[model samples]
Target: MDTNGMDRRQFIKVSAAATAAATAGVEGILAARQAPAFAQGTALGMLRWNDFVPASDELLKKTIIPEAEKALGAKITLETVNANDIQPRVTAAVQSKSGPDMIMTLNNWPQLYEESVVDVSDVAEELAKKQGGIYEQSRAVAQSGKKWLAVPWAIVGLTIAYRKSLFEEVGYSKFPETWEQYRDAGKKLKAKGFPIGQTLGHTFGDAPAFSYPYLWSWGGKEVEKDGKKVVLSSKETLESVKFMVAFWKEAHDEGGLAWDDSNNNRAFLSGTICATLNGASIYIESLRKPDQYKTAKGAQMRTDIAHAALPKGPAGQFAFHVPFSHMVMGYSKNQKAAKELLRYLGSKEVFDKWFVSQKGFAVGPTRDWEKHALWKEDAVMLPFKDAARLGRAPGYAGPAGKKAAEVLTKYIITDMYAKAVQGMSAEDAVKWAHGEIQKIYG
Candidate 1:
């Protein structure tokens, strides 16, 4: 995958460090790896994200479930849960060694529960070979310590969604293509009474999506390349902090300090802001509900809104592409049925149907799957066509494991930027973040 544009200042440094640290751990683990063969069972169970797009869940129930059951000669039951509840539910299930046979989760969670999850390297390899090749960033998140603990499912592409009319009103025919220009344009928009919005609160999705890309654009990283040392105290990071503080004052509202994942979506749709960084969900919502917008009905959203890959920085353009994954638990008695169900769903035919049902919001994991017609048909989605390749896991300068997950879950990086923007000194904020990160890595 071509994640060449995903890093600003320290791509080489972060990649090298994380690779060395992760490779050693993987080698030792794989040397002792042992896995059971596929033995079909009578039934299967999967825990999945409750569909934000209702049609998606409805279609899955009507199509994939019946097809998989028929193909595997087993009844597969799926339990849909909210995104926030997934970690606690999965953790409890893993602890009890009695729960669903498989589960869907965001980010590199399989790394955190590797010991309790069955190795699905076979399933992953089969899909990879069949699909030409899986994305490099996807592999990084799914593999850990030499085990394919989870199968790479899809990339939830993140990009900039903005009001085209608003930008053009300020002499910008298109969204700015660089950080400096983006900030300047934002300032202009702010003066025009429509500030750009970015959440600074502890939102799991939008918070990291915006903050990490900004940090990377400034050449700042959470940790050193070895994935052990905290590096947020560097000059590059301070520059990012200063930029964020000024940008927040001029471009964002105070309410953003407490906004959650849905806040920006609502804000953008309500005509409260000129732009925001988000997944296709925000843009999709605009199209799905043109009545909510200030523009007249019909082609209002399609004509007024557009997307851009995150603007380039002095280091280069960067963005966060979070990989969603699916895994089977080792303790499940129905592991064979679960694997069969995964295989059935992994087929291009099954996934393509689900992808369209969601209006192409779900990204295909590999390059070959790009043959789906969605990218060609929608201009808003075209920027995300290579998202699986041009994005990074949140744990950029570190291994995607328990420690990195902890830092992210606790909102360490988000809090750091939030504090700085809220008037905390840049040095003090970095110090606080460094201290917090040290507790995790150490």
Candidate 2:
């Protein structure tokens, strides 16, 4: 919803003269205006990241398959194939035409898989028709040259979480507005001898979420203009890296580098960090536990935390947002049936069961559904809903975006960010990183 605080420097430097994001946005809008409804059919086959387990099998038995049967007189049988990697899962499925009819994709996956997946623009058109005004950022995700490749299912938005009791104890008057203010708040707390604890580890999916906000907020663009290049090495990128290193030193404990995905949870719960980087799911978990927040396990004993928009930098504030992009593949035996399944999943009835009843497996990237009874009092998910309003997908979009981030992870971001938090200058680590990305993307 809010594309605020995006880094525009590296993108400017690397400009082919046209920005990929801007163009992508334009194309998607245009498609939404013109795409026709695809015809519906019968029982469709599906392939998902989770072939037989949590991401897929569990989803089908509990939500999708039953919903589809009810909506389209269709039954979906799933095929399990381990994606060579996330990017390949969609592309190879489209290119080879050997898998199931539908796919469960990451929000940005459609960009790369568009060439092979079915034209999903109509699904989104239906969403807009249903909601009056669809969340615009979601349009960015579904856009390709002339069609939408994915349907938004779930959103993972980020927010700042800090201990309210700690802030009160530190004599803080109010929450910080921009990232700088937030940083200063952390500094003040540290000055008072309370360490703001956080983690920077080689943990699952942490580095990108922790730092992407800064890069984006610093105004860094993932690709150069002219829609033809990547900007992982631009000045905006350099500055973003610089900011993280500074933030890490100032806010994180000395052992922050040793922290893992569960570290922030453990630390904030233990009152180790004054404020921590976390998601709505944390609060949701807390609410479910109830006593954890009230007892030695409660939000106070656990961390009487509150959520804030990620802090703003000199350029702009930022945070990582992950959205689930769902789609039916081109090879689905039941093409129309697959589309019907998609439609049913996005409807009011199924959404309740999938998102709330099943606990966010079918997520909403936009807050249009915020009024749903489930999220209103969801102590944790409500903030996530707020964060979703400001969320943005990965910089590397579609095939190129997904593929490049992979390169960034294998070559730069993963171990590089891990090491940078350990005292390496981010620039130095990224020097090796940018070089690594060049080799892979080029």
Query: Across residues 1-442, which tens digit of lDDT does each residue of candidate 1 receive?
Result: 2475445544454444334323432221223231112233476788988866778898888877876565444668888998888889998998898898999978766777878888898778878887878887678878886678888888878788898888898889978988778888889988877898888897767888788888888888878767887787789888888888888887777688899878888888877788988787877776777666655333466568788888877677777777788999988997755765676577776777888876656687888867777777887777777766677766677776777778878889899989998789989998899899888888
lDDT of 1: 0.77
The true-versus-predicted C-alpha distance at residue 213 of model 1, in Å, is 1.6
- After best superposition, candidate 2 residue 35: deviation in angstroms? 26
C-alpha RMSD of each candidate structure in angstroms: 12.5, 13.4
TM-score of each: 0.88, 0.72
Q: Which segments of model 2 are wrong by more than 4 Å?
A: 1-64, 77-100, 187-205, 229-236, 253-263, 292-303, 358-363, 371-382, 396-419, 437-441
Which lDDT tens digits does candidate 2 get at residues 243-312?
Answer: 6677666755767777765677666655556776665545555545656555233434434657767667
Model 1, 390: alpha-carbon shift in Å?
1.4
Off by over 4 Å in 1: 1-41, 296-299
Task: Please list the C-alpha lDDT of all candidates, in the order they appear.
Answer: 0.77, 0.58
